[model samples]
Target: MSDKSKTQDEDLPYYDHPTGGWGSVKSLAKIIARSRPDPGIMQTLWRQNKPGGHMCTSCAWAKPDKPHTFEFCENGAKATAWDLTSHRCTPDFFAEHSVEALKSWSAHDLEMAGRLTHPMRYDADSDHYIETTWEEAFEGIAAELKQLDPKSVVFYTSGRAALETSYLWALFARLYGHNNLPDSSNMCHETTSVGLKKVIGSPVGTCKLEDFNECDMIMFFGQNTGSNSPRFLHTLQAAARRGCHIVTFNPVRERGLIGFANPQSPMQMLTSSRTKISEHYLQVKPGGDIAVLAGLCKRVLELEEEKNGGVLDKAFIEEHTTGFEAFAQSMQQTSWADIEQASGLKRTDLEIIAGMYANAKKTIGIYGMGLTQHVHGFVNLAMYVNLLLMKGHIGRFGAGISPVRGHSNVQGQRTVGISEKPELVPLDKLAEMFDFEPPRDEGRTTVEVVRGVLDGSVKAFLSLGGNFARAIPDQGQADPAWKDLTLNVQIATKLNRSHLLVGRKTWLLPCLVRSEEDMQATGPQAVSMEDSLSNIYGSVGKRKPAGEHVKSEMAIVAGLAKATLKPNPKVKWDDWLGDYSLVRDLIEETYPDDFKDFNARMFEPGGFYRGNPARERQWKTESGKAEFTAPKVLTALGELPGEGQYTMITLRSNDQFNTTVYGYTDRLRGLEGSRYIVLINPKEMADAGLSEGQMVTLESAVDDGVERRVADLKVTAYDLPDGCVATYYPEANPLVPLEYHDQESKTPAYKGVPVRIVA
Candidate 1:
């Protein structure tokens, strides 16, 4: 760490202004200046979220049918500028920095070094990456893969992969006779899938983009809309303009939820005026979402007793949902004292929130990682569904659940059959189309893959995109295990720390990003992605490829498939490589209901909605109806932090998206120049005898005896709940044990790790 990275307690600036507006605009400009200026960034911005434009490569917020001239947000612009920058990480650059030295560089420095220009292999002797031919790389990877058992290799996919690439990647895995497909969702929103599936019969959110407009109330559960999904702020601002109640339940009162000034709005930009959001904001504990939700439900049930039949939606419950009686009985038995202790909110506050929900004719419940990245994330989601079901929110116009997904197409990748559980996919249909028997046995997830590698069971690993080492929890264990792998391959646009985790035969294959033109033998091609709201849209990059050697993710997958698998007459890899439409046709054949006319739909105004069964009231569960779940416990973690320990909430800065850090400044949180600081409540800091700007080490409180700690982190006092602290993710991920995760979903409990600060 440099001296410039050090912080002074008195020098910390408190941001009194609203989020977005000029601040967001200035931040984007700063990033553009820091990164080599790209002249075409504005042109690319104009096309983003438009009919024929590329999807914003950041958040999965749905694109509107009739979009604005600039549909991207400040964070979206940063992503674009970051991708489109002229800086290149060519072989010459690699010759200068050794792999070991590069490992010590900050994540932002590594990414800013720029896009990889050619295929390269890690030379163990020289400790540097040397250029390698694509053919040699493919042949080497294929040879190793052929030697290893399919079950011993893991194919990791990132959410950045479009549906076209993901479908082909999944097909490639199936053709190779394995289902070891662990993806980004396993580290984030797997709970949303498992929990929502059992409750609403759909793994995805039930709401559409238009729901925000017609909904009477928008309730946010642990979503930092401003930084994570800046585009969603426009919807919230519009809803606020219509007098719709905007409520928030999170440990931190994020700037986005407090107020927003849309950069695209001329009046607001000119006057520096902002729209106030979060009509009601409650600061709940880090892992207290489930308890808070239960409290809301309990208050609603009590209101029903007071008002008799008027409070409960008896018609919707009896007609479209089941298990309501059990859910209501459980809520009736919930104690106020228990709820208050678990959540840091008072009973009166919860009652007020319940009154708002009951009075609203229609409501939309939106949540993010805060609710889904915990030990009891699955139960928390189930409880959230119960709250919505009590008032008949699902399947109704403008009333449903929305999980604000990170990554551009994380949901799309899952929808295209990237799952460890093969039963979730249409294996029979795939077998019929590809002339091969698809693997039906369950495979490994992200955490399982980490354990597999550590135990020497997983010999080879491949990633379509994403920084596997940095993104996954327990990096202390997983990082060192990468060297034990027989082969490691990465298909990415830029260089990340994960690329440095070289194995015996490691290969770094460069691929074109969504902002680059994907030129195939046939013509320029467009890949499709499904947003958080199930909106499928085509993204065609207007800029030239970063390098002539950079191939599209689809082409890379096809090449690998051709190299590894024998010629299958039914599956035409060569033809699909030339024309992606052929791949879409095969996808349509496999998923007839969802992707019927998939190619043609790419030309639609904003593409099309994939259509959620729950939205139409067509439940696909065993009961054939939306079912309410009675949570066994109300707390998210089912335990309290021990004395001298606090629940550590992992977070992302304004300049970050997932593991990709564009810069260190988190302007929204009044943080700058560094990402190594921790936020603690002032009262708690005093209780611990810790001064602001004091360097401390955070050690995991788990009894695993495998000490996990991050040292040299400066502590700063902020407005957080007692016994809770916050730190940047990836940096703080080591404190979260790989085994400590949601039991049902296997999603790491990144947001709620118990740790103690040592001075």
Candidate 2:
């Protein structure tokens, strides 16, 4: 390493030491500085999850049935530690801190205040949030909603909302006569749903955890299962021990892909022995996934043609799919030179990967945000499906396309119809069931919702969960749009940056966390979540109430509906909220063939698996087969900066999830105490004559002039690809222009933002 690069590493908070293990003592200090932990809250949190009552809702991964030994991960602990805080945002507290003053505070400082004690409203004159009665808050919101055109209202659902509440909210929106539903999914995995549906006729993954054990080769693309989905580590370790070939392709050399210490394995944990995960690691350039996937498909076709005179599942392709010839022709036209240059991979590496697929009997392709958060996200996903189809890798155990979701119920939310654009069949069924006309017009997506708010077309914003302002990109634009809203309602458990960005008239309604006991008229309620594998399971909170006034998310949604649309007798929102089973009954009515015995199935230890058409190789397309989409011309890749500017991909630290910053420590990347540094290659730093650890500024290279410039950012030299740098999200989100999104998926190209570094 160059002296400058070595200097940069030495200046990092944790240097090159691992985050956990003996280095934890120093890691803890860094965490304290970054998280700004409150002592009183830590004490209360420590007392939580004691022998009897409940577990922390935020860290539900702790196996409740097992011994209390393994309770949380570092990030999970931080979440609980933050929540158990003693600080309260009382009316007096708000009185002292003006909204303007609070805006200037860091996101960490604003959220450190435990929770909102009572309902509050944005008082423009006082420039603070004043506590108000629940009745007045509800009445004010109801009156404003009643005055606006129902279509002008946008309902936003965050991943944090419970199944019961999400269902009620969706129902309320439909009854209110609008389909303008925008949620967290739009910003994350909207591409997963769109692409999967087009290829397999189902939005969910086909493989289950059980299939993970049966697979011969597991190809993980664009996912860091260790940090994003740690629970899968055990499964991957087991598969590796069983001699399964594990291939991982990602821009970052994730520690999890290198290996993992199974916490459950007594012998391994005692010895600190780690299991090898990936047999092969391919570091594809950011935004180069499409070319890589296309290359894989091209090689697969050649192998089929040479070995078996075109053995590519001709029967399945001819009978079930559309546009295969066009797709195949496009693949053939992609020259190896272009593929190698675009994908940052040589011909030999791709051939080895192709050979692995050819030899393996069963293969599974799993991916996460790296594939979805791009300009051609949908096309990239479709190419994966195409490769799987080429090898006849569908409809079998351990073989399918699995998009690992972040939040537990993210997939379930979509499964239960939390979409802006409802399918024709579901829409028709909903209209028939409610005895009212369902809106035919498609609603605005997340990006569109923000645009609508800016243009004054949207009147009300009702978010079920999530810190919207902090989660979205181009904050310079999104922040102002949020403030322009006439009414902004947030149904949440804790205060966050979104709450601080209060609108003209706002209501902060506190709700129950998922890990807390939710008591309704029918008694204690149990919710269900569908994991990434499409296995539905029951999740019951065993913890006591944080406060008596805290209402379940379902009850809050029902209450809001009762106050706003109770006069309209067409919908029975009250009946459904009374018992969660009733909501399941409604789901049964909507998807009768699939959810026929919803209540009965949910009672089972591991809930029943939803039928996946792809699992059976049953493609429900126009031709009743899995269709192939032709690849677009590789012209856009030329648009990226090649000379002076470099592309900066924004990513989350292992310590953070979405917009929720648990702490400042990134164990794998050797980062600690701060999240403002950018990772760059030593060669690039030297070529630019830049000194390590020197503060620098970044400006967008795109012609849109979105003005996303990060100033005084510390530079850290690391083993990154040339012409590429990386920084943490939300902080780097400003560098991404809303217009610079996937043309097909509308997902912000958060992974490949072209930027210029300044001294």
lDDT of 2 by residue, 1-759 (tens): 111223234443332322233343344345555545445434434434333323333422222222335434444455654544445667788888888888786666676666656777888888888888877877888899888899889998876565556667787898887888777778888888877887778776778667777899999888877566665665677799999999988887776677676554577656756677788888888878887888888888889878975457777676666778889999999899988888888889998998788788889988888888887788778888888877677777878888887765777677777888766238888777878777777888878887787788988899887887777778777777777788899887667888877788888887766555788778888776665676555556645555666677787787788888856565776677777888888887887766768888764433567778778878876667787887784422325776899878887877776777766667766676678888887878989888778899988888874567888788887766667899888888878887777776577778878899988
lDDT of 2: 0.73
In candidate 2 the C-alpha lDDT for residue 270 amounts to 64
TM-score, structure 1 vs. true:
0.98
| Candidate 2 wrongly placed segments (more than 4 Å) | 1-87, 308-315, 566-570, 634-638
Task: List, residue by residue over 194-254, the lDDT tens digit for candidate 1.
Answer: 8899888999999988888899999999899989998888888899999999999998878
User: Candidate 1's error at 662, in angstroms?
Assistant: 1.0
Candidates' C-alpha lDDT:
0.88, 0.73
Q: Candidate 2: deviation at residue 172, Å?
A: 0.9
Clashes of 2: 5
